[model samples]
Structure formats: C-alpha cells, structure tokens
Target: MTDIELGALLADASQAAAYFVDIHDRAALVEAANALDFTVAAANLAAADDKDALLEQIAEALQFPATFGGNWDALVDSLGDLSWLPAPGYVLLLDHCTDLRDAAPDDFATLLDILDEAASAHARAGVPFWALLPVTSPDA
Candidate 1:
C-alpha cells in the first residue's frame, strides 16, 4: 500500500496477511502510528546484523517467554502463540532491515515468510500482526 493508504491501514489492520513495508524513512510511519490510535507492540531491528541478532531483538522487545528457543522453528512457534501482546494490533517494524536483507537474503526471506504465516494465523484469531520493513523501492 502507498504511504497515503498506510494510516487508514493502521486502523483497519485486516488489509492483508501481513505488510512488507518498503520505505526509506521510518519516522513517517512511526509518526503516523503515534498520532493515530494504533497501539502497536513494535520492535526495531536497526542493529540486527544477522539471524541471531534479529531473533534476540524481537524476543526481547516482545517479551517472548523463556521457552523461546531462538531458532527458526522456535521463532515460528513463539509467533504463532503470542499471548502477551494484547493490543488491538501488533506491529513489528524492522527498521533498516535492508542491511540484514542484503547480508543474509535467505534468512531474510525465511523471516518474511514466517512473519506472513504468523500474520495469517493471528488474523484468524482476530488479532492483526504487521511485519514492517524497508525496501529500495515499492515493488522490491
């Protein structure tokens, strides 16, 4: 969705299975979220240089349980079984994700796929999950 369409999307979180936001600046998105009524349980991965960094950042930010095994399978299990985030919607902003995407494209793609799957599962339970990221361009 375009930037113009993003704010409304915050209120209407059922847009798609998940969102892979491709924007150069995150300030705009965060500003919009702050100005609006969207209560997001967000995490920023600007410092995540690899898979472990990514997992740890999310686990810390979202307060995942101790059972979170910090692996791909464990990540999926944790995401699909979120009971802590009781917000109207859950937003995960992977700020500066382009770095990780470039360094480990395979892992990044797997992360996106897992995030999308988690979004689908959460949507079924009436909770919106957003996996926001940055791309060079809109279609990237």
Candidate 2:
C-alpha cells in the first residue's frame, strides 16, 4: 500500500488536476482510492505502448463513448466531457509509462500535455483528474 494519505490525496484531487502517483504497484493505488470514501473514476492503461494505443486505451478505460475519435483533438474534446465518471475526479493508473517514455519520448510528452490540459479543464469545473505515473527505479 502507498504511504500516501487517502484524505490528503482526495483533498488535492478534488481541485481538478492530473497527478502521477510514483508508486510501482498500480493496484495499491487503487486500494488507496477505495479508502478515499467516495467514488473514483479509474482507468488501467497497462497495455498502451504507443501514442495511438495509449489514446485508445485511455478512451476505453475512461468510458469514452462510441463516437469518440481516436485523435488529439477528440481526446481533448472527450476528456472534459466525461459525464459517466460520476465522481469527484478520475485516475489513470499507467504502469507502463516508463517503458513508453523510453520508446516514445515525444509521444509520452504529448500524452502528458493532454492529461495536463484535461486536468486543467476539469479544475475549471471543480473536479479533479489525476494521472498516477510510476517512476523508473532509483539507482541509489
């Protein structure tokens, strides 16, 4: 389990922003969400290896509708339009972000941009959207 506090996470999460939790175990993070005592929209993007794959996985995980176009513009359009979430915020547990980052750095950056922009949009609407990103292992 993450040492991170659920209440604090929720408090920060409530403001509508994207967060990348730095824990390796994505499931533990979900457990933390459970302790949050409220609904949390979650998406597991473990198989997304590239930009298009990532986009499609994200769309499916976040419950994007059938009409969702798998493109940058469509991504931004649909991200802020998640009426099905029904929670204070949304969390994307990306276990393979590091691998994707290594193989497709530019794509990873674009993904970050999209997530940040979406989070900002949700913030404007008083909801939080977080990206729980895991870090590469430390050498120390």
Top of the candidates by lDDT: 1
How many pairs in model 2 have backbone atoms within 3 A of each other, for residues 3 or more apart or on separate chains, i.e. clashes? Answer: 5
| Model 2 residue pairs with clashes | 16-127, 16-128, 19-131, 20-133, 21-132
TM-score of each: 0.78, 0.78
**Candidate 2 Cα errors over 4 Å, as ranges:** 1-4, 13-16, 24-28, 37-46, 136-140
The segments of candidate 1 whose C-alpha lies over 4 angstroms from its true place after superposition are 1-7, 22-28, 31-39
lDDT of 2 by residue, 52-115 (tens): 8888878777778889889989988987788866776666666556667777889888878888
Candidate 1: clashing pairs of residues: none
